[model samples]
Structures are given as C-alpha cells and as structure tokens.
Target: MNTTIIEHLACLEINNLILQPPFHLISNIQWNDKGLSFDGDIELYSSDIRKTDFIGRVPVQIKGTTTHKKQHKKSKIKHSVNKKDLEVYYKDGNGVLYFVVTINPNTHDRQAYYRSLAPLDLKGLLDKLEANGNDSITIPFKKLDNGHLERVCKTFIQVVEKQPKQYIEASNKMEFTDYTFNYADIQEDLFDPFEEPVYIYGVLENIEIPIETATLFEIRKKDNEVITIDHEEINVEYELKETKEVVSLIIENSLTCEFNKKKKTGKINLSSIRTLGSYLKCLKLIKYQLEHNKLPFKPFEVGAKINNKKDFKNVYDDIKMYEELIEICNKIGLRDNYVFNEGENLSSLFNGIIDIFKHKKYQLLNIGDNRKLENTMLYNLKLSDFITIKVMFVDNEFIDFFGEEILSKIGGLVPKKPINKTTAEWDPNNWEEIYFKASIYSNESIKELQKATNFSFENLKLSYTDQYHDIGIDMTINIALDFVNYFDESLDSRFMELALDLIQRYLRKFPDNDLGKINLYIIRFKQFNKLSEEEQEDILEILERAENENHKNICFACEVLLQNKLKARKLFSSLDIISQTTIKDFPIYRLYQNLG
Candidate 1:
C-alpha cells in the first residue's frame, strides 16, 4: 500500500463523483485539490478535485471499509467519518450530500452509499457521537443509486427550509419565524411515519433568557399549558396579511402552519385532521416558499401585548408586554408552586396560584396537571396546630375562617391535603412533657383524620390500646381539636379558652365519652390569672366531677393550676398509680405546664 497511490485513488474517487450524473447535475457544486481554507474554500468547501450539479448546492462525504451487504435496495458501507468534516458540513447553508463510494480493485465497479448528514440530523447525534478523536464517526451509509436521488433532494429541502434564516446570535431578546407543514392538514391514512418529522421552525429575538426549543409547538409540554379544557383546538392563522389576496391560489389543501410565541418559547399545535385533505406532513414548505411570491410564515410584522389574563388566550408575540409581565412577576418573587383545589371558586384558586407562580416560571396556567400537582404539594406540606377545616359547607364559597386563613382562601382542606400530622399532648402528671395522641390510633387513622379535618363521617376509624381497642374515635377527635384551635399563641388565656371551647363542641357530639376531653388541658394552668372568675369556675367544675382515673388526673392538674399544692398532692395521692399519672397528651402542651 503506497501513500502516494492511496492519495491518487482518493483523488480519482472525488473526480468520478464530480463528473457523475446526479452530482454533475447540481450547479454550484465542485471539488478542489489545493487548499483554499480547509484543504479546499469557505474553509470546508475550499479545495476538492471534482464537482457536479444536483437539485441545489450540496456538500458530500463518503465512508466505507470496502465491504457491502444488501438489505432490500440499500447496502451498508461501514467507514469512519471525521468529526471536523461533519461540523463543516452542518455549518454550510446547504446540507451535505455525503456518499460512500467503493470501487472494486479487480472489476473497477463503483458502489455509492449515503447517510443523511443534515444540520438537524447531525445536531441530534452530535452528543451521541463516539470520541475517536478526528475520526469519531463510523457511519452506516445506505446505498444511494439513481432511483432515490429525488427523495434525497426532497428530504434535504425539508431539513434546510425550516432552519431559521438566521441562527440566533445573542442568548437574550431574540426571535425568528419558521415554516413547516401544519399537522392540522394531516390525513392519517396517507402519512408515512418512517419519514423524518419536520420541525415547526421560527427565529427568536431579544428573549430576556433564552430557552432551547426545536419548534413553536414545544413551548407547551401539552396542549393545556396554553389553553383551557373548553377549547378543543387553538387555530392561529399564518396569513399573508401583506397581500390579503382574495384569489386563494388553490394549493394541495387549505394547509396552514401555526406559531405559538410563549414568553420563553413558542409552539404550534394540531387542531383537527381530515381524511380528505392531502397529508400536510408530505408538503415541502421550502419548495412552496421558493415557488411562491411571499413566505408562508414571517416575523411579527404587527405589534401586540399580553398585559392581562385575557391576553394569554391569544397566541401572538408581544415583546414589551412579555417583558413587563416578567418584570412584575420577578419583582414580586413568585416561586415554584401548586395551586388551589379544582372544586374551589375559580377566583380564589387563581389568587392562590398567582402568588406562587409568574415564577417557577414554568406554566402560565396549570390546568391539566391539577391532580399531580395537588398530590406533590400535599406530600411536601407541613402545617402547625392551627388549620381549621370546614365541618359543613352550605356552598363551596365558604372558607374555614376560624383561623386567619393563610395557605388558601380559607385554610385549604385535606382529603385534599395530607393527614400525616399527629397531634401531641402534655403529660398530665409531668407538666413539662407531652406525648403524641395520634400514635394510639390504628394505621387507618389517616382516613379518620381526613374525616375529622373534612368533618366527613364516612368510614370513620378508631384506635386500639394493647388492652382495649376503642381509642380511635377519641384520638381522631383530639387530632381535629388540635388543628382547629385558632387562639392567639401569645395569649395563654385565649389558648386555654380555645382548648375548653373545642372540647365543649366535641362533648356535644360524644357526650358519653366526656373523659376523652382530658387531652385538651395542655390548656395552660399558668393562665389561671388570665381567666375571668366564671372561666376559672367552669374549668374547676369540669375537673371536680371527674368519673375515672384519667379524669381525676385532670382534677389534680387543676388543683395545681389554682396553686392549691396541698390539695393537689392530696388529690394525686388518693388515686391509683394509673389514675395519678398523665392520661391525655395535647399539641399545646406548653399551655398546661406545672405552676411550679
């Protein structure tokens, strides 16, 4: 193998391609030998020895190992392609017309093969390309013969046409427009999925922050991002508004390409498909543009604004309007958010949503993802003792207003929210300690807690003691009581009052289980001074009539609250060990600590 002879053969192959039929047909096509910029002109197109003519100007690269295997009409030529050469090919305005031509040394019969080396095709595979230094690509070139050259030219046009007249230079405030076949005109029966999907192309200008997108349709993850459930399809006409011609040159079909310019990126969506129309996917947008007097898609020659909620419904790019909205939302510091219940009044839910988004800056409206977002928000939510949920709603307009509502129009309800929050109570005997009452409930306690928060009695759950299992109702009730206490944290008197107030309400429903109210006393004894005489008497009366060990412990706790140490010790001593010790644990344990 002589180096000079190998170079001669390479030169000979290049000459044959340039001198051949399809290659010879393309005018602006040539091969040079001496260096122009990159061994040949504009650096890559510099110097090749042979040249040719085709449908349009195209560059060519060939790969092979002198082996061919037929699979139907095409055979594979496994040869390494240079990465540098590939980049140069993509950089060219016209796509590369690459081929793998192998000539048998004995017969001198030439077999040419090719693989698509379009800009988009290379862009997608650039990351996956092997790292073999200069020769990183060992392409599997398909056999390219006379019969399929027209199809190749058609595909080449499809790739080149959608490319923005300009590749955006700056990352910010940039915009452009592109043309592609409208999917709305697609006839499913006529579509061939094997054909490469043409992208909806457009140029972007002056974007505050640039987004990576392939087409206008990609701006939305789904149709709902930019539209409501009520709207079946959003039709944005790509009009030749400049001409406004009445003579509609009847083309293949009433085909139109849509462009949806969102704040970050824009997209096109399909509305309806017709069995009657020619499949839009097959239409060559670039060819149409070349043949017609005007481009089907163009820049925003008109100005518009999306300053309000109504503006979002319309699909148009408004630069100043978008910048203004972005400024306001960013200034307000919106963050990643999940919104209000779907069942809630629309206005209230929207208010809740606006507070958080305008940021995460992801979706302008989160319509379809309501359930998934709800679940995630619930999973991550943490609430303190006060989250008053409605027991009954005459209408959905009602808010659980006992507490100054924080998370929602009213404290957002659970069933709708997680019930993992376990209520705790102070140890009755040892004022400094508190225990979780929720731990006593069975695994099904979550459903019961949801019932408590929602005040829905369906399939209520109960708790089990090692000795006796009937504490679930009590635990569930206390859990509800814990969350619904809306008293001011700083006011010990208010804390104790809320404790008593909640217990009395539950007592009305579970009168037989009055002993269950013992947990409520995490109600502060130190606040003994804060209570009026009537309030003190009411608490004392409740304790004095104690019927069991747990109840007597509360009675002893009350004696201590009144500073009657002698009576408190005596009351405690008279009880059995179980009765003397703490029975109920409350969430507001600090409210019930010992006076000492």
Candidate 2:
C-alpha cells in the first residue's frame, strides 16, 4: 500500500467508459497564505479534450488516506484506470479508450487522481449530473460549521436501541421480583432495515453514564426451587464521534447504490456504504436548497437566517410548493446576476428549469487583454468534485461509458441504466412522405439527420448552437452512409434502400476519413428475402469462389435485382426477388454436401 492519499482517491475515480462525459477536475488546492494554488496538482485534469478551462496550472495537496482497499500479491497486482489517466490520455470524446493500469497497492507508483475544482460554475456541473440520472443535489466538499450542520440535519430522525434487560423490583417493594421483556429482543426484532439510518452511532443518546457495566440474567424455575440458567457481565464503551439534537421526522425517501464489495475470500453486498451516505448528504443539501429558495451556491446566507426550528418550518413549508426553486437560483447565478432575496414567491420566477443546477457557462475571451471572469475564476478551483457529485445523478449514457472502460479497469463492474426513459421507433417514416429517414442519401435533411445519426442531439445543442441544424443534418447523412447499407428488411425496405443510396452518394461526394459502417441493415435485408433464379445463381457462384473481400457487394447485387423488377412494374413491391430463388452454395447447403 505504498500510495498517496490522493492516489487512493484517484483509484476511486471512474476510468473505462463507453460514453464518458468531458470532465474538468480542479485538483484539490494546497491552501497557504495565498488564496488558491494551481501548478501540475493531482486534482486538476480534464477527461474531455474540448473542455479547456483549467489547463496548465492547478493547485495540488497531499491528502490524508481514507478506508480504501489495496491488494498485496504480485499475482493480484492487476492494472486499473483512474479518472486522471482517462482525461490525460484521450484526445477524442467518442471511441473505445483503454489505459493500461492496475489498482494493486504496489501499482500506485503509476496512478493519479482528481484535484482542482471550479467553484461558481457548480450549476453547470449539477445539470450534467442530473442529465445522467442523478436525483441528488451537490455541495462543495468544504467544511460545514456546527450551526450549518445543525440547520441541515434539523429534520432527521434518531432511533435508539438499548441493551438487553435485567429485571428489578419496584422502588417501594424491594423484596418482590417483577419480570419485564428483554431489550435485545425488541431492539433487533422491531426495527425495520428499509428505513435510512441518519447516523449509526454506538453511543446512547439518553443514557446518563457514558461508561457503564450492564448484566443479563436468565432465570429458570425447577419445581419449587428457583435457579439462574445463564448470566453474563458486559462492559460498554461509547465514544460519541458526532451528536445533534433530536429533530424527530419521518423517512422521506431512500436510494440504493447497488454495488458488490469484495470480502476476505469472496464477494459480498456492502450495506449502507457508498450511495446511502452520499444520498443522505444529497438530501441534506436538497433540504437546505428547499428552505432558502436558493441553489447550493451561497448556502451561508440561508444558514444565517434560518437558525431556529420556527424558521426551518417556514422554509420547509415553502419548499413543498416551490420544489424546483433551487434550479431557478442556479439559472440566475449562472446566466444572469443573482442577488439574495428574502421575500415570498421565490419559486415562481423560473419555470423552464430542468437542469439549471448544472454549472455550464458561455465565456467570452478578450484577445488583447487576457482577464478571467470572476465567476469562472471562482469555479475553476472546485470543478472536479462538482463533476463527481453531479455524475452520480446524471443520465446513463456517460455512466455506461465509464463503467465499462474505467470501473471495470480494476475488475470492478457497476451496472447503470439511463436515467431518462428512451423510446425507439422501428419506422422512420409515415403516411404520405418519408420526411424522417435513415438511409444512404447524397444529402440528408435536418429532420433525417437528427432521426438517424448516432451523434448526441443534446451535445450538438450545447456546443454547436448556431450551425447545429445545418451541420447536424449534413453530418447525419454522412455518418449514416458510412454504414454499408442504410436499411435492412427489419426496417422499411424502401426507406432503407433510398436512404442508403442517397447517403452513399453524399459520402462519395463528401467523404472524410473514417470508413462507413458495415451496414447491418443491408446485410439483414439480404438474408431473409428470396432472390430471382438468375440472381440466386450469381450469389452461389460468388460463394463458391471465396474471392469477394466485402459481403456488401453481394447484398447490393440482391437489392438491385429487387429494385429493377419493381421499377419495370411501375410500383413499389414489398417482396424481393431473392425470396423466389434458393442458393445451392449457401453455408447450410455446403454443410449438407460435406455430410453427404
């Protein structure tokens, strides 16, 4: 375990991703007399090449180690990936990326972790997280004052379970013995596990003695003689790590992390470890946002105003109505100027606020005089933590990417589904005309571009707002034609064929570097349909030679025959001529010949 604390944290960061987001980590700062530090720090790294804010300079600090696992054996010294390596290595956002690494204790010599953070642009980070499927709200991982902690946890529930019982007679009747139910029976039996535990402290909240000895006795009566069946003396030591007032409240919600932990020998489910605590913290942040009618930024203002239970109640009540008020706060703070307001009707201001909590900002740079925006300057320090917190709450596209490439890098697998529901249409066209199509076309329309292309529409909206419509459409056609064929019989034949032809022509005219897709649709189209006797004979002849480098030509040859007959008939027929003929040299027929 010869690794730095920052190395351990780096190990905890995500690595192999099928669809990871562009990340900018503001490495942890070395806080000295100077306000903030930035210079090749472990914390500041960008996983995304497009994001170029915190590049050359970022503050770094040597952090204290937490309870992270380490491997010992050379055989077990497998390589794994952390967030920094993924950010530092990849030049493109899309594509399969692998960095050779390991999570073994001895392997820490080659590993790194996140550092710097962008402070004010938190809403952008929050939105990114929310986009991934995160229901959580984020706060900078800074120290919270006692008062602030108290204000946040004011509504949490505390349930105390006492030790087993020893019967004692009434104060007046000392001689008489009275039997009561044991404490252990009720404590273990009555408590429900589904309920969230706010803080699982061993200390007794109401018990007067911090250090005390307790005894348990089991009595047995044999005929007339009374005898003690069993007895044990137990000494209890309770150290209160943290404490808060009894703020009795109901369990509002619960979330599960759904990950496996490695035990001494095998795998075991870790209860209440990663997601539960983070979610509890998330809930607290959400509660704070609900009360002050503000986002996570400038939380101290709410702390100053709502100290007592009365103010807390008022804020809580207001939150039920304006549940999304924090989103508005984020929007104002990020886009326009945000000033603190204490009056009523705070939630009504921003209605179209789905991901206002994300900390994305459009920055204008000056060519002659280089000066940073105050907001950008403030956020540049905390960007990494902000992203980590938000990623937990975001949509599945990025999660799947990271889980497959990064988390699994250390032989760890975390299953994730898209946060938003995805609905797929088998057909891209309708009644009169095929406005939306996915085919090989020379020029693809804007609607067709969005409908067919694998490029993220949302990303296009964010990055290429001006030319997204025109570029996206052209790009879509280009990418679709890259596929060997546009449509399969699994899809609408006409749409697929026409789309493929148009897209192929477009590609031929404006071909870039990347080779087009193998066109699985076109491949599928050739497989199920019957071909004319003459066309079937040609396929058999080609199959006998094993000379064709591409199977696409065979598919093209088949589709062409079907189209020729349809054109001569002056009608679009659903049936392909390939369905009418059988190939003697098919793989199945070849296998039959070998058996014979």
Candidate 3:
C-alpha cells in the first residue's frame, strides 16, 4: 500500500478511540486542505444531560506514522513541525493536544503517543530552536499508555467548574457596601498603669445602623499556650432619625469586634485595622509587664524591658512587632502621616528614658538639688573637659532637652574671641594688649573669621596710623614667626602653610615696605622648602616683574630660599651695591657674596 493510504487508515482508528463514550469529537472540515493544522476539537461532557455548564474542550492535532525507533531499551517516536505552523497554533490562544499513532506492518498492532501544548510550551520550544540555531524542531514522545489523557480531562473539568463559584463570590463582594468609619473621630482615653482590662472608645459619627455595642480584646499567647486575656467593653447607644438611626460606640481599644449574647468576640489575629495609637498603648502595657517581672495572668514567662539594650533580643523583637503594626496601619487606609507622627513622639519618649539610664552610669550630671556643679556651667570649662561634657550629654540623651543654646555657648568658648574682629585698635605703646590681640590670630581663628565675615584673608582690611602702621606690622609678623616656630616644634605642616599665607597677603598689600619682609624672610624660607616645583616656577614669574630694588632684593632672596645654585649665582652677579640693612638681615647674604 502507498504511504498516504496507510497514514489515513491509522488516523481513522485514532478518531474512533476518541469518539468513545462521554467524549465528543468535532472534525475539522478543512483538515485535508489545511496542511499540518489541528485535526479536530474534543469535548467531554457531564454524565447528566440536564446540567448546562461548560465541561471542557481540547483542540487536537493527530499524526500517523508507521516508523518506530528503539533507544535505551525503550520504543519512542519523533515528529518534526515547522516554526511558522507552531507559532500560528499557539497564537490562537486555545491550547492544542497532539497524538501520534504507530502501527506494526505485519500484525497491524496500533500504539498511540499523546502530548499537550500550552502557549508557554510552544514558546519554550521556539526558544530551544533559536538556542540551537534552527528554524524547525523535532519533538519526541513516549507511548501514552499510563492513562495520562484521562487525567488531563479530569483537571480541565475541575478548573472550568471553579470559574462560576469564583464569579459569584466576586459579584457578591462588588455588591456589598462598607459603612463609613471616620478615623478622625476616634477618641482614646488614657488607662492607669495599675488598671486591668483597659477601657477605650472609638466615637463614631453619622451612624445609620442600630449598633448595640463595640468591643476590643487583647490576646496574649506563648508557644501556642494561652496567657493573660484582657478586653474592653464599650456601650453603644442609638437614636432614630427621619430616614436612619444614629449610633454612638465606645470600645476599649481601636480593634473592631462583634458582640452577641453580652459576650464580646473578635479574631485573635493581629490585623491591619489595629491603629498606631493602639499599638503604642500595647507597648506601654508590655513595659509595665517588664517592670513587674511577671505577666498579669499566671503560668507566663518573665518580661524584660523593651528599652533595655542588655536585653537586646527582646527589645529587637518588640521593635519588629511595632514595625509590623505600623505597616498594617499604613495598609488599611490609615494615613502614613499620622503613623509617622506617632512614631516620632514614641522615639523621643524612648530616647529620653534611655538617656536617664546612661547619665546614671556616667555620674556626669548631678541631678540632685544639693549638687556640687551646675549643668549650665559645663560650657565654660576647658576645651578637652568641655568636649568630654558634650559627649556625655549627647550619649546620655540630654542634648535635645537642654536645647541648642548650650551648644552655641560651648562653641563660643572653644575660641578665644569672636571671628568678626578684624583689627586690634589698641594704643601702639600698649604692648600687652597688642600681644593679646595677636595671640588670637591663628589658622582656626582666621578660617572662622573668613566664614563669619564672608571675606578672604587677603581682603581683610587693617587700618593703622603712620606710626602705628610699623608697630602693627611688626606685631603681625612676630605672630607669624611664633606660629612658624610652633609648626617646627609640633611638625604641623598646616601651621607653616597658614603662617606663610598670612605673611604673603601682608607683603602683597604693602610691597614697598621692606620691614615686614625682612622680619619674615627666615620663616618664609622655612615655608618655601615645602612648595612644589610648579609653585617655585609661579614665584619666579612673579619676581620677573620686579620694579624697585626692594622687590629685586626679594626676588634674589627667593632664589636663595629655593636653593637654586644657577639662579642665585646669576642674581648675585647682576646686583649693584646693596643696602646695609639687607646685607645684615638676609640669611643667605654670605652665600650671595661668595657667588659674586
């Protein structure tokens, strides 16, 4: 027989098997004309004909092949399908069921293999083909002898049957309307720490239903064992209106509950409807439990303080619980703004209590009335002592309570004088006052002054009379020389840089005056040794524009300061008769003479 005739006969036998009892097959009219498409749709129906619900329908593609291959002691069949046909079938949305029939030529025995194709399955097949660089792919199948088709039919029926029940539940939820509960109208009454079964109220406004009462419960459990149980009972009163009834409800806590037969009932689960305010109250109650070292009810474990870091495990657990409570409040339409506000207030209260404990440990703050030292006087102490006090205050959590004024006072005491002072307008003859004023001219003081006055060190204007000018210049130069010496003793590079910067600014302002430069040459030479090659080049450029002999002598002094043998030799040979003061004061005068 021809191959077409053999394949057609095999398909007929497969169709007969599908058309068995309880299964209905719809043949595709264009099956012969449409190449390699699905052969038919199979429908399974309920046993009762009166039932009018959708059972399930599966689209199938049937193939017949006489060829079979054995691999690894197992008989299997492989069939190839083009990529275009697979995409078309999958995009139709209805998944396909595939059946391959293999027949024995001599005995005419038939064996069937089946597989199902969902959209994702087909996409995965395409992905595999692309991964292996192929446009067509072959899918292998084992014999469908394990009742897999019956299982697929049963799963389809079960899934389709669930849709109607889901639809009805959704429709009912959509039809139901919730009563408006205003969070703003909620009122909380404080409970005494000693009280059992705390009472609170949620004042409801514009109520239309006849409400009898509202109630809240506190359920405590440990390892599935019940502990102490506390509850709040609220009295509800109602008044009739023209169209509806107005009701007022008072509940012990913010938790919503139902009442029946004078008994309050609610879910023991912590739910999202619990307000942030209620959680705070629970924290306080827990703290009380810790302080008493026992639960209100018997057969309970000891409670540890939630704020105690020594009991950090318990404290962390409490913090996590509160975080969950706050998260739930955010989830259930309680505005985050209110939750954050409550969180901040709780944090401040906790920090204040913790600080009290810390201060007790340090013994820094004398809280008693007959204390030897006052807390206010801590700002006026020495620098190191003041720093110690500040740290103690911050660690003990007293900083916020004392306000920022104390911090400002401490900052003022750190420096000798205010940074805004630009000039020491003392009598030139008053050496003590001049020395005291110059003592405050430090790197830190200059930086603070520049920050306060918004003026650079170079821009700071210092005024003096002709007689006082020399004296003021001498005092400033002396201060710079002292800072240089201090830098040498301390090996502090910043002090040297600062001294150099101050001297350079004064020199630039009064270039004609040689007194300041002469007094500062030794210190300048010390600073010059620290400059980079690029900085030395910049100084040489500045000196190239010298006009007066004082400026020329300063230039020659710079070469000597840099210790440049060639430049110093050339400058010394080019110099004329020098001033007596320059020869006497310049440190490198002997070296210059030897080069000449």
Candidate 4:
C-alpha cells in the first residue's frame, strides 16, 4: 500500500475511535521521509508552508506526476513532511507523543512507510471519521496462506511496536508477544483482567480480598480553629497490639469547649476478634452432653461471654462440672493468670459476653443466618453465682429458646436480589451478553462453541485492534501514554472528545489544500516542547482541544457555586478572606494560604 494511503488510513481509524463514544483506538505508526524540499522552498510565506517546518510533522508531496513506474528512474527529490502528517501536539511543556505510521511495502525493503502523528486530537478525529462512516475498512487476515500470514504477522508486530508506553504499562503484566494464535494453545495465551488471587498464607494465586472495608479510614476536620484546639482529631490513628494474639484498637476523640473544668477521657473497646473465650464455651457444652450421656446436638459457639462474678459464686464450682474445659482452655493458649473483671457496669459485662459469643457462633453457621439467634441466645445462655443460683433458679428455668429452622432461614436472606431470568431473556440487548447458544448439543459442538465464544481475551484483541487494525489506536496511545496519562475511563472519554472536537474545528477552517491547522498544532506542541512539525496536523488540533476541555471540566467539578449572597458571604467570612474586594472577586482571583 502507498505510504500516503497508510497515513490517511491511520487518520481514519483515529477519527472512528473518537467519534464512536465508547470505543477507543490504539495505534502505533511512524511516517517515512520528509517531503521533497527545493532551495526555492526557503523564505516561503509563513502561511505558504516551509520545508524544514514540515520535516517530521506531516507528509506533504511536492505537486508533480510520475510516468512509467515499472521502468523506474531514480531522481533526487528532497522529501519533507507536510501539515497533514503532524497529527497531535501538547502545549504545556510535556514531552510530545508522535504517532509515526509505517507501512512496509516489501519485506526486502527495511525502510518502513512512516508518518509521525501528533499526540492525538481524539474528539476532533472521531467526529470527522464517524461523519465519514469510515470505520469498516477491510484488513486482509486469513491464516491459509503462509505468505499472507507472514505479512499480517509483520504488520501486527509493527502495530505493537507503535503502541505508546502507557498502554503497555496498564496492560496486565503477563506478556503476549510469544502467545500462539492457534485454538489449541488458547488457555496459555488467554489473559483475564478480572481473575482475583487466592491468599494461602498471604500468597495470592487466583483470588483477591476486597479492600472495601479494610483497616483504612477517612477523617475530616471542621476548621482551622477547631483543628488547632483538637489537633489529635485531625489525624486518625489505628494501633494493633501483639502482646498475645493480635488485637486491633480504634480510638476517636473530638474537642469540645465545655463549661466544666475537668478533662474526661472515655475509653471504648471497639471490638475483640480471635479471642480465647470462644474455646471455653465449646468445652463446657461438650462436657454437659457427656455427663448426661447424650450426643451433643451441636458444636458450642464461642462469641457468648461468661461472667465469673454474676455466673458463679466460686469459679471452681463451675470448673468442677466441666473439668475437661480446663484442658481445652489451656490447649488454646489461655493462661492461668487470664481474668476478665466485670465491674459495676452491668451492661458492659453483658455486652462483652454477647460480642464474644456471637463472633464464634456465627463462624460455625458460615453460610446461614445467625441473626435470628441473637435474641434467643441472649435469653437461653445464662450463668448465676452458686450462692445466688438457688434463688435465681427458683424464679427461672434455662433452655435454648430459638429453633434451628428459624435461625437457618434468617441467615439465608440475601441482601442483593437476583435478576429475573425471564425479564433478562426478553430484553434484546441482553443477547449481546450471551457467549454462544447453538442448539446442537454434541460434545464437539459444545467445545467449539465454548472455545470460539470466550471473551476472556477480548481486551487483548481490543488493544491489538486499536493499535494495529485501526489508525486511531496511534492517536489514542499518544494521549494515554505520552502526555497527560489518561489511565481511567473518565479521562479517556474527555480527552478523546476534546481532541475530536479540536480536529473538526481545524479542518473546517482549512481551504481544501491549505493545511495551516496542522502547522499551528505542531507549533503549539513545539511551544510546549512535544511534537515535531512532521506529524499529522489533524491529530495535533484534537489533542490540544481535549487537553483544554479536561482542565475546564476538572475546575467545574471541584468548584462550589455561590447559590445566594448569604451563603457566599458566610463562606467567605469563615474562609477568613483578608479583603472584601478579594471576596467580591473570589472567582476571578486566586488566593494563597500559609499553614505556618
């Protein structure tokens, strides 16, 4: 294919990705040769297009015709890039990303057909490409012929070479250059971005623990004065003590101006996990069953707490009933000196036992409802001092109040409702999500269907397609990897949109042959020290536009609007604005604050 055609094709692809809102293009391309530069081309009108300025920017052919190409006569023609080649440019002194589209017409000729593109005018390119409906280009890829496959592989490899640095970094680190395309070797090459890792002794393989509700916490302070008064509150701290088993403690403090003079510190034990109380309860229950010569109906739950003062007159009396409990406690590392003091705070003693018991019992019914047992367990699990037991036993009888069926049902309630299969099937869009649904149920057919339909490697294909199959990939990669790292979806969308818009705007201002926008973008890029003028102009315009829009949107989202004069006035006063004029011109002016 002609190198000019390749440059056009690259621009076309870039246009398609940007215009197609949800789709992204990744291209790796470089243009070859500067346009033919003549001595007379110098001192040309700045608007008339200069040769040196167009060297690396865009491909501009000096207008001339060739005849009898089969019998070639080599002539000295200085090749200089034109405005069309300078694709995208950056304005903020960031290193420029140039997409050079290279097409190797023959394997023998090592010199590739290259077009160094601008960073990316994503929004602008998309609008133009989509408007042209130039997305469905025929890329000849058939595996039957060795020669054809070789060319395809070469082109594909070239595409990979052109990818910007960022895309490669964001990709799952498992390299794919050596992966075989054959169906039998599918699993070896397949990449799954979603497969989490399993942590076996902190070694993760395929499952990952969610960090949604982890040890991390966020703290917010009211104002400078309050922050100064309660400096400790400004920084939230979490401490883990490993004196025995790990115990995590959380403490929160807020400063308040009080009329009273005394300073009071309230300590709250947030929680206790993996505690020793759990083992003791199970042992006691087992002993009770053994004494009665009855099969234990269920394992003991650990979360329930025991009160030595309230439950037993002498701890030895309870120990006498379950001598085996002493052995079980010692096996679990419960020391003889270990003692829980139940003070006058009756509620605290009860709450502590409940916390301990629930934690243990809940683990046993791992996948069931332990919630229903809360009230029943509270009433049924009881202890009394031997001296007071006779008096209390006269007034009360102990029994397990809640049934297993109720507890099981309560635990089974799932918070998230499942989607209705009937409704989902009825929707047309849902069919897009189906992998493969052929009615033929033979083993070979099923295997074929499964292998052919799996999308685990779809992302890899998308990345490859954007990089090599479509020209836009070059544009997308430039923005994503080269300049403002557009890693997330939001930034990608905005940048692409902005770039496409800028490109279209530039194109609209051009006279059919005059590629001035290309020059301006290159100049702008050079102003920020990024792109060479020899890149594609359309790409540069879009990149510049996308960057501007991104900045604007960020500012808009973070700024709070002054709805009314009163709120603004109060906020301004609270903000401690030094001058009324500064407050009045808040939006127009910038303020600097010193923490010292």
Best by TM-score: 1
Model 4 per-residue lDDT at 305: 24
TM-score of each: 0.28, 0.18, 0.25, 0.15
lDDT of 1 by residue, 7-48 (tens): 345445544444444332333323443432132211111223
294-409, model 3: which lDDT tens digit per residue? 33333333333333425323634774665554443232222222322222344543343234333343243334543543353322111121111122133223332122222333
Candidate 1 ranges beyond 4 A from true positions = 1-58, 61-74, 105-110, 120-137, 145-147, 161-476, 479-596
Considering summed lDDT, which 10 consecutive residues are worst modelled in model 3? Answer: 238-247
* Winning candidate number (lDDT): 3
Query: How does candidate 3 fare on TM-score?
Result: 0.25
lDDT of each: 0.38, 0.27, 0.44, 0.26
Tell me the tens digit of each residue's lDDT in model 2 across 118-170: 21112233334557755433321222111221111111101111211111111
Q: Going through the candidates in order, what is the number of backbone clashes in each? A: 50, 81, 2, 89
Q: How much is the lDDT of residue 329 in candidate 2?
A: 31
Q: What is candidate 3's local distance difference test score?
A: 0.44
Off by over 4 Å in 4: 1-32, 35-397, 404-596
lDDT: the better of candidates 2 and 4: 2
Q: Give the lowest summed-lDDT range of ten residues in model 1.
A: 220-229
lDDT of 4 by residue, 197-276 (tens): 11111112432211111111222233221111112222222222211112222222111111111322222221222222
The residue ranges of model 3 lying beyond 4 angstroms of the native Cα positions read 22-36, 48-53, 68-76, 146-148, 154-596
